[model samples]
Target: MYEDFGEILINGGNRGLGLGFVKQLLSQAPQKIFATYRSAETAKELLELATNNPRVLIPILADSTCEEDVSNVAKMVSQETNKLDLVINCVGYLHNAEHGPEKSLRQINANQLLESAKMNALPTLLLAKYFQKLLKHDQPSVFSAISA
Candidate 1:
């Protein structure tokens, strides 16, 4: 499917499944791919890919949970490419070093719940809101999200 990918955006592409998607997409020979990461320190592999494939792979530092950041990323992309062929929201947070899912009803915390929702649920809407301008309204422009 990515054989014809002109310009693609993959949110949270620093690690895990997102990382896999980035690698696989590269193998599929996409024209240009924008991969977002929250920190450079944790994005060594992604950075390496960006460095090796300078003309095709671009690693962007962005926090998907932040609306302003998302908007800024879209602006940056607009500077490079006027249209986006695909957008895949791979952002999700079920657990981290400081927290994990509640094993029981009593273990849930307000902050954790909000954090999960912000990362997992809001990215698709926010990306769409800010990047719709970069999409081709008259042609095939795909927007998608992955959940587990």
Candidate 2:
């Protein structure tokens, strides 16, 4: 699918499946790669992996729930690449510790559900909205998310 390469933007590429995608994409020799991470510190490993690779770039910070963050990423991507071939929204989180996942139907509070929806769903919607211009006429401009 990536045979004729162009820039690809990956949100939440700090680790796990996102990181794997970045690593494999790097091997494809795309024109450029823009990966986002919530915490720069958490992305050190990935940063190091792409340290000497000129084709990789990490410009967006991971805050998919924030409109400002998403907008800024879109702008940055537009400035860096003429077109986006693929956009992979890999931002997600399972409630942790004090706010772990709601197990029972009765335990599903408004706050928990809202938080999950924001983390799991909203970003993709926002990304499509903000990046619509950049995706124009680009056939197979993929937008994907990994959900549990």
Candidate 3:
């Protein structure tokens, strides 16, 4: 099934899980791998990988939570190919230095919850909305979204 895959998109390629997917998928020899990262500072590894494999890998700078960024990414991908064989969304927000994991109901702050939703939940929906056209081929396609 993977051998026939022509194009693939990975949303959170800077993270370990997403980067692993990109590395493994390279074996399949897909025509293009569109990997999105929020910031250049955090995406050094991904940028390096892209530098090594320029023809196969394309690193895009995009903030998944922003609708405009997502839309622009879709447009950019469309310029390369009309169809995407697989899309893996690994952008998840569990906790940061300021906000740790909630241990109990009382620990669940409203703002943190909203921030979690924005990071963990919203990106996948927005990606689906904008990239649906690229995923609508006659062949089998997959869109997998990982959560926090």
Pick the lDDT winner. Answer: 3
lDDT of 1 by residue, 3-45 (tens): 7677899998988888998999999988899999999998999
Question: Candidate 2 at residue 1, lDDT?
Answer: 69
Q: How accurate is candidate 1 locally (lDDT)?
A: 0.88
> How much does candidate 1 score in TM-score?
0.90
Instruction: Determine which window of 10 residues in candidate 3 has minimal summed lDDT.
Output: 1-10
lDDT of 2 by residue, 35-54 (tens): 88888788987788767675
TM-score of each model, paired residue for residue: 0.90, 0.89, 0.95
* lDDT, candidate 3, 30-115, per-residue tens: 89999999989989999999999988999999999999999999999999999999999999867988999999998989998999
Off by over 4 Å in 1: none
Report the Cα lDDT for residue 38, model 2. Answer: 84
Candidate 3 residue runs with Cα over 4 Å from true position: none
Specify the poorest-scoring 10-residue window by lDDT in model 1. Answer: 132-141
RMSD of 3: 1.2
Clash pairs, model 2 backbone: 37-62, 38-62
